[model samples]
Target: MLAIGAAVLFAIAFLINAADMSTNDVFTSTNVMLIGLALLALHVAGIGNGWAGRRRR
Candidate 1:
């Protein structure tokens, strides 16, 4: 559930970046992209941690 929420948030951020890019806001778009990627990485890592812990038990 948490992962899904994070992913949705990331998607929204990505969309914002895309829209900004289309409007020629390169700097802000790039920042948004970076933030989205970071959030996605964290979300995936969190899910992996949860799954791995369950498997180890």
Candidate 2:
């Protein structure tokens, strides 16, 4: 799920950059892309896998 969210964020950033759209400093393409990368890292680290059950032994 977090990976999916990151993908969406990446797409949004790409579009914003490709279209040459102007945005606030906080919402700039680079910031959005960085946020997406953070989310991707979290996903890779299993931060939001949605599975909290103990492993079977």
Candidate 3:
């Protein structure tokens, strides 16, 4: 749930930044958005938060 909220926030930021990039030619915004989407994708696929990189107690 929190992740979704973060994704939404990031998405809005992404859109705004993308618009800015159109005139400024910057990559930071795109990179951040991609990272956010990637994390959300992992979460949705149930592979987030060190799922395979950690052992459950």
Candidate 4:
């Protein structure tokens, strides 16, 4: 599930950032962590419910 994926991503980012609290971490940990949060927001907004489904006339 996308939520699970996002959770994993967030966790990984946290680990990376924690391991190297520097501005030059290889993974861009802050960015990745923000991305994960965005994913979580999407999932919370019901991304799985076919928000893009076209209305049937």
Candidate 5:
């Protein structure tokens, strides 16, 4: 799920960059891309797996 979120973020960033849209400093394509990368890292690290509350028996 986090990976999916990251992919969406990356897509948004790419679109923003490709379109050359003007945005605030905090919402720039680079910043969005960084955020996406962070999410991807978290996903890889087993964070937000959505299975922590479940028990396997």
Candidate 6:
């Protein structure tokens, strides 16, 4: 859930940043997008699996 939340928050940030790209710069927008994407990947792969669960042998 935490990861999902982080991913959502980051995505929002990315969207906002993207919208302001013209006022800002390309690097900032690209960095925000990259971070958001990374968080989203972690959310789907880790948090979605229940982070505290045990693994099989």
TM-score of each: 0.40, 0.89, 0.45, 0.65, 0.88, 0.42
The worst-scoring run of ten residues by lDDT in candidate 2 lies at: 48-57
Model 1 spans with C-alpha error above 4 angstroms:
1-27, 47-57
Best-to-worst order by TM-score is: 2, 5, 4, 3, 6, 1
Cα RMSD, each candidate: 5.5, 1.8, 5.7, 4.2, 1.8, 5.1
Q: Supply every candidate's count of residue pairs whose N, Cα or C atoms clash at under 3 angstroms.
A: 0, 0, 0, 0, 0, 0
- Candidate 3 residue spans exceeding 4 A from truth: 1-12, 15-27, 49-57
Model 3: pairs clashing at backbone N, Cα or C within 3 Å: none
What's model 1's lDDT at 20? 54
What do the candidate models score in CA lDDT, each in turn? Answer: 0.59, 0.97, 0.65, 0.79, 0.97, 0.64
The digit string of per-residue lDDT tens for model 3 on 1-57 reads 537755875976678776775434444676667767776777787664453556679
Model 5 TM: 0.88
Q: After superposition, how far is residue 53 of candidate 4 from its true place, in Å?
A: 14
Can you tell me which runs of candidate 2 are displaced by over 4 Å?
54-57
Instruction: Between candidates 1 and 6, name the one with more favorable lDDT.
Output: 6
RMSD of 1: 5.5
- Whose lDDT is higher: candidate 4's or candidate 5's? 5
Displacement of the residue 34 alpha carbon in candidate 2, Å: 0.3
For residues 1-57, write the lDDT of model 5, one tens digit per residue. Answer: 999999999999999999999999899999999999999999999998896676779
Pull out the clashing pairs in model 2. none
Model 1 / residue 10 / CA error / Å: 5.4
In candidate 4, clashing pairs total 0
After superposing all C-alphas onto the true structure, candidate 2 shows an RMSD in angstroms of: 1.8
Clashing pairs in 4: none
Candidate 6, RMSD to the unseen true structure: 5.1
